[model samples]
Target: MIATRDAYGEALAKLGEENDNIVVLDADLSGSTKTSLFAKKFPERFFNMGIAEANMIGTAAGLAAAGKIPFASTFAIFAVGRAWEQVRQSVAYPKANVKIVATHSGITVGEDGGSHQSVEDIAIMRAVPNMTVIVPADGIETALAVKAAADFKGPVYVRLGRNKVPTIFDDTYKFEIGKGVMLRPGTDITFIGTGLMTAQALVAADLLQAEGISARVIHIATIKPLDEEIILAAARETGAIVTAEEHSIIGGLGGAVSELLSEKCPTKLKRVGIKDRFGLSGKGDELLKYFGLLPENLVEAAKEILAEK
Candidate 1:
């Protein structure tokens, strides 16, 4: 198991070696955000912008305009909450090649409490125009997504977790910008998951299989430009859907899937996520279980949705 932030740091360092134009800016959080690895390797290419998150974003935008691929790093709450206007006007509006790779996202930001945890980052970033939002499930996917964001031109927001999560993919796995991968296949129900929840969805599928319930698991790495085709097909074929994410049910993966399915194909759905509330200070795994974000929660949601179906 490895924290996605650790993978991001290693990937950014490797990317620095490959591309001279790749520059990194961090808001006084190089150590926590793991951009410190890049700083250690290529100090010239890295700029520690102090505690000013908004200024860091603007600087990154300027660097992007100067024909450089700038990656801005910080905590998810500060990146999306504090520097939202700069992100919207300076980066997204002009479609600058600024990659806002935020770490310590979601309730996994443990012990920092609700003020630091960013459960609503995905919702707000997803709402921004010209912003591509990604929530990679594990380290392998995080590395692939980081490379993909660096390659693609435009504003991108990649949300990463603080805690070490189970590795869900290997070298054989292929990662795309706007694609969903089906990890497990089933006919009865589908669990559409993003971020750390994807790993839990797979566990839930296994648990369900033992109980004679065939549950399909789909991992959605990209939140914006959602894989509508895959979701629609899952809804049409399975007749039931459950969305799990380390975010609010409102305007996150659950909201996106609900909107798509409601318009295109109405399917019985259940969302397993934070229920419009702030995070509490606690251990990461305990918080996940406390908020019903474990595999058992997905199992319960699946059974409920299947019963309705």
Candidate 2:
């Protein structure tokens, strides 16, 4: 098991070796965001942007305009909430080659309370034009995503969490931007999950299998420009859908899937995430359970959708 941010830091350092134009900027949270690994390897290319999140974003945009791939790192809340105007006006609007890889996202931020936790970052970033949003499932996926973000042009936002999670994908796993991977096949219901919840979806699939539920698990690593083809296929095949994420049920993965299915298929759907409420200080695992984001909750949601079907 490994934290996705750890993989991201390692991947950024490795990418720096191959691409000299790759630079890193952090708003005084390199250690928390794990960008310190990259700073250690490429100190000259790393810029400590102090506590000014907006300034860090503007500097990254300037670096991008000068032909550098600037990776801006900070807490998710600060990156999206504090520096949103700069991100929208400087980086995203100009389609700059900037990667905003924010860590410590969601209720899993743990003990930091609602102010530190970022439940709406995904929604707001996805709303920006020319901005690609990604939520990798595991360390392997995170590494691939970092590489993908470096290679892809324009603005990108990659959301990562603080807690260590189960390694769901192997080295053989290939990640494609805006594509969803079907981890398990089923005919009864589809469990569409993103970020760490994708790992939970796999576990929930096992629990359902024992009960002959036949749940299909689809991991959505890319939230923006969603894999509509794959999602529609799952909805058509399974007839019922359950979307899970570590963020809010409003405009994260659940909202994206709900929008797609409503327009394309209109399948029975349930969302597993923090309802319209703020996160509180607690242990990471405890927070997940408190918000009903565990495998048992997913299994129950699947059963409910099945019952309705």
Candidate 3:
């Protein structure tokens, strides 16, 4: 029952009640994106833009200009692709108080395939100036990020998945934006993952324990303004790093880490993700298993990284 998407929708509705300045807009995907719950409660504050992501983004910008905090919801693909220019021009450039809540990110959209899947959303969003990108690990983090974004006076992109996984936190994990959470202690290697892959890294670390392999699991929820100090410390201690992401190997968390490590620490690193391929119709888990995001795949990657070390 670890659906962060559900928590995001619920948090938005709750946050709306507390903050009168908060407003919500969806691109005709209130049901799938889970913003319908907010619409049902705060009908006057919620706006449905009828499948037009670009228009929704522009509308959000106008709301922000008028001293209102607007949250726009849509699929990850649409938020990053269809509404990219609008996001860049209206939200990021001016640094508006617009929160972009994108659901079903990565291949978790499953049977909807590549068209609906968003592997490059983070990279694109992060590259924009003044955009804060967040990939919450579970429901709690999602709720926390949603609540925090309303306070921050800038464009924030929060990514959440659709699948139901295990609740890794004890309802006490402090999810601070731009801070990475270290879940396990290890010296041999550092396993860095974001979004859904963070859970995989945790499970992989447990499997590595039986083999006497000490691998640290670092949950990188914030992607844009990366926590470089934490990453550098882990790299300095472990000497080897393995990155797991549900995005392409090009420019997501893997790219962010590689960029920092190459210039800062020059640590040995291995990246696991999609290799510039599009997904097709299939269940969520099937795509993950196919894309080498399974626990077995992570264990194998860790073994390979350790071998090099």
Candidate 4:
């Protein structure tokens, strides 16, 4: 197991060695955000912008305009909340090649309380017209996603967790922007998930399989340009769908899937996520359970949705 933030740091450092145009900016959280690793390797290419996330974003946009691939690092809350206007106007609006790699996202930013944990980052980032939102499930996927984001142009938002999560993908796995991968195949129900919840969905599928329920697991790393074709196919085949995420059910992965299925397919669905509430100060695992983001919660949601189907 490894933290996605750690993988991001390593990937950034490696990308630095490979690409000269790749530059990094951080909002005084080099250590926590893990951008410090890249800073250590490429001090000249890294700029520690201090606690000013807004300024950091603006600087990144400027660098991007100067024909550089600038990666801005900060916590999800500060990146999306504190520097939202700058991100919208300076980066997304102009389609700048700025990668807003925000770490310590979701309730996994445990012990920091509601102010630090950012459950709405995905939704807000996804809402941006030109922004590409990605939430990698594990370390391997995070590394691959970081590389993919660097190769791709325009504005990008990569959400990462603080705690060490189970490695869901191996070295052989491929990462693509705006694509969803089916990890497990089934027919009775479909569990579409993003971020760390994708790993949990896999576990939920296992538990359901033992009980004679064939649950399909689909991991959607990209939330903005959702894989509608795969999702619509799952809905048509399974007749029921459950979306799990370590975010609010309001406008995150759940909302995206719900909107897609409602207009296109109209499938029986249950969204397993934070119920439009602030995060509490506690351990990461405890927060997940408290917010009903556990495998058991997903399994329960699956059964409920399946019964309706």
The best candidate in terms of lDDT: 1
Which lDDT tens digits does candidate 3 get at residues 1-309?
Answer: 678889888898899789998889998889877888889998999999998999999999999999999999998899889999999999899989899999988898898778888888888998999999999888888888898888887999999888886677777777788999898999999999998788899999989998999999999999988999999999999999999888888888999999999999999898988877877779998988988998789899889878888
lDDT of 4: 0.94
Candidate 3 — which residues are off by over 4 angstroms?
none
Output the lDDT of residue 114, model 2: 90
TM-score of each: 0.99, 0.99, 0.98, 0.99
Q: Please, what are the lDDT tens digits per residue for candidate 2 over residues 1-309?
A: 999889998899899999999999999999988889989998999999999999999999999999999999999999999999999999999999999999999999999899999998999999999999999989999999999999999899999988899999998999889889999999999999999999999999999999988999999999998999999999999999999999989999999999999998999999998898889999999999999999999999999888888
Summarize candidate 4's per-residue lDDT along 4-82 as a digit string, tens digits. 9999999999999999999999989999889999999999999999889999999999999999999999999999999
The lDDT values for all models are 0.96, 0.94, 0.89, 0.94
| Superposed Cα deviation of residue 208, candidate 2 (Å) | 0.9
Model 1 deviation from native, Cα RMSD in Å: 0.5
RMSD of each: 0.5, 0.6, 0.9, 0.6
Model 2, runs deviating above 4 Å: none
Candidate 3 residue-wise lDDT at 31: 87
Clashing pairs in 4: none
Cα-based lDDT at residue 198, candidate 3:
87
Q: Flag the better candidate by lDDT, 2 or 3.
A: 2
